[model samples]
Target chain A: MAASAGPEIERLISLLAKLPGLGPRSARRAALTLLKKREQLLNPLAVAIAEARDRVRTCSVCGSLDTSDPCAICSDNTRDQSLICVVEEVGSIWAMERASAFRGRYHVLGGLLSALDGIGPERLRVEDLLRRAGNGEVREVILALPATVDGQTTAHYLAERLGPSGVSVTMLARGVPVGGDLDWLDDGTIAQALRARRPA
Target chain B: MAASAGPEIERLISLLAKLPGLGPRSARRAALTLLKKREQLLNPLAVAIAEARDRVRTCSVCGSLDTSDPCAICSDNTRDQSLICVVEEVGSIWAMERASAFRGRYHVLGGLLSALDGIGPERLRVEDLLRRAGNGEVREVILALPATVDGQTTAHYLAERLGPSGVSVTMLARGVPVGGDLDWLDDGTIAQALRARRPA
Candidate 1:
């Protein structure tokens, strides 16, 4: 709206400012860089953004963002239908995918249980997970939850509920991660899960 | 377009993918995380992006991106008219500003002279720079070009041209930065330019 600012610059700066570690000044610099490199960075980024925006979706069965409703893993006939890898978020699912070790389908729990946040099992898709596990085809359930206390609590709760179903339960190996989100983990982690995986 | 992906997740993925280091898969994961924490990171990021985009602009005189045209520095009358700092890009200008050392105006050359790409002084605003230098107000020209060969070439050429214009020619101190972009340098190097600056 200012006489000095153009519409394109304004749009770019605003979007850039919202990113992590960038403030208003940094955002302005970033926007200028994009404009200057529009032929290389901006146009391609715009195209990539549009394509991803149009194509990405969530798997209804597991809540993972995928191009397919059931996703490639769920639809793959060779993948183990009798196993489901339960994770706290879609990022965790992607991390598992990056390792290329998991042959089972994924079930994204959306988030971990947190008492401070009053996030009950009912608030999450815990019921959906239970209903899916009850379908009788699943032979194993892997809790790829975080190593935090909340993550442990959520994993325990799920294991307790699914135990009576006679299905085997497992979890990702510890010490492969050090922080909050599994998405930030290196590919080595997912591979370790395949090598040293044990029953929960 | 896929039955599995939803609008929110898609939007977030597209947005995240446009970042410097993020690819499609990483973008998707980031989007999903933001969606799960929409109230915390996603919505605020979106709003900040929009606001910055709306407010940021290029300084008409110096080409620095800002909320004002002449920008805060260019409009400030207290800055020395007898000294003009020449930089390769607006990032360099910002680096100088962050140090709060320079009390003169800036002239951004946009980029260095590159013969490999057939970029010459004509492509850059070299003529405008000469005209501005000859405007009778500026008494000294300080070159703050990158240490790259092309950057040094441009600085040399500018020095040669501005020599006859009766303005003193000097350059920022060297050896402080080793193969790093001037943009990435700390404010200390920029401030040191004022303290130990030498004849070009």
Candidate 2:
């Protein structure tokens, strides 16, 4: 068991440890850093977290987290509302936004269909997506999920469900990434690249 | 510039990015995770940080941070008052405490002597430590600083300063770690292990 650095600091460390990349040791270091720079980091972080807790809300239509009912992307008139990109989680939406190539709205599935983890379509926002697809406003549903087993399963299921509704379903193409060397490309990626070869 | 995920979420991400282990990308992920688990994580973390900020104080005697003035270790009567462990920062004190081997009080130096970094003895708690050593109650002062160049320089300076004051100053021995493999050991560690060899 980890020794407590008093109750308050210990609680802070434990919470920090629950973050995506941090563990117990790094959390303790982060806590000490916060304590050392109390006014600069700890106070500001506390205020930010409290503000986020009070203000953040999920988009009722798309399930993306934001300060408003509909997220910035969903509410923006400039974005292509006809194209909806489906992602595994809100983090994936953020990743897509970082690329700045997709100027379309998003649908967050909460998680991929993982049978081993007991996560089904019912546990995700699948019904909401199907409902959105049937509304006729959306012309294309881009499946931007991870190329994993569960992700592919969810994508295939979504394609099957949305096919009868007449909305065109597409997936991100898998190949050797841009700026990647052919020598370092995996066999699977090389095979994918060969299969999806385009006209010169 | 990084794109903002609303004002509150962006602020939280920026503040979290300043933590020891998390960078901007990981901070964004953490912010999203907090938003997703608002009731479970974000609110409690905010409360914990606020409580730590309001209640935590540095020990006047040892410079260790806690809810009390003398801190838990310093105020505990069961600990050996005659022995004091000197460390570079408060984080080092926490690391020492986690080992649960040292039952003595600690003195935080705030930082090591780094001429390149413009950190001198005046900037540290050197005078406080010297004064404590001169008070006659402390029989041994253990230097538990890092094995860096600055750490050794500070240790040498402290030994010189405390030598005239009659309290024996000792440094943590350098040798192979308890479970370390000789094949992966650095040359300096191997040399130290050879020099500090013991009969079985």
Question: Which has the greatest TM-score?
Answer: 2
TM-score of only chain B in every candidate structure = 0.76, 0.97
lDDT of 1 by residue, A20-117 (tens): 55566766666666655655655555554444445656678888766667877677899898889998887776567667777888898878889999
Worst ten in a row by lDDT for model 1 chain B = B1-10
Query: What lDDT does candidate 2 reach at residue B98?
Result: 80
Best by DockQ: 2
* lDDT of each residue in A87-188, candidate 2, tens digit only: 988888777876888998899888988889998889999899989988879999999999888989989999998898898999999988989899998888
* CA displacement after TM-score superposition, residue B30 of candidate 1 (Å): 3.8
Each candidate's lDDT (Cα)?
Answer: 0.72, 0.89
TM-score per candidate: 0.66, 0.97
RMSD of 2: 1.3
Instruction: Give the C-alpha lDDT of model 1.
Output: 0.72
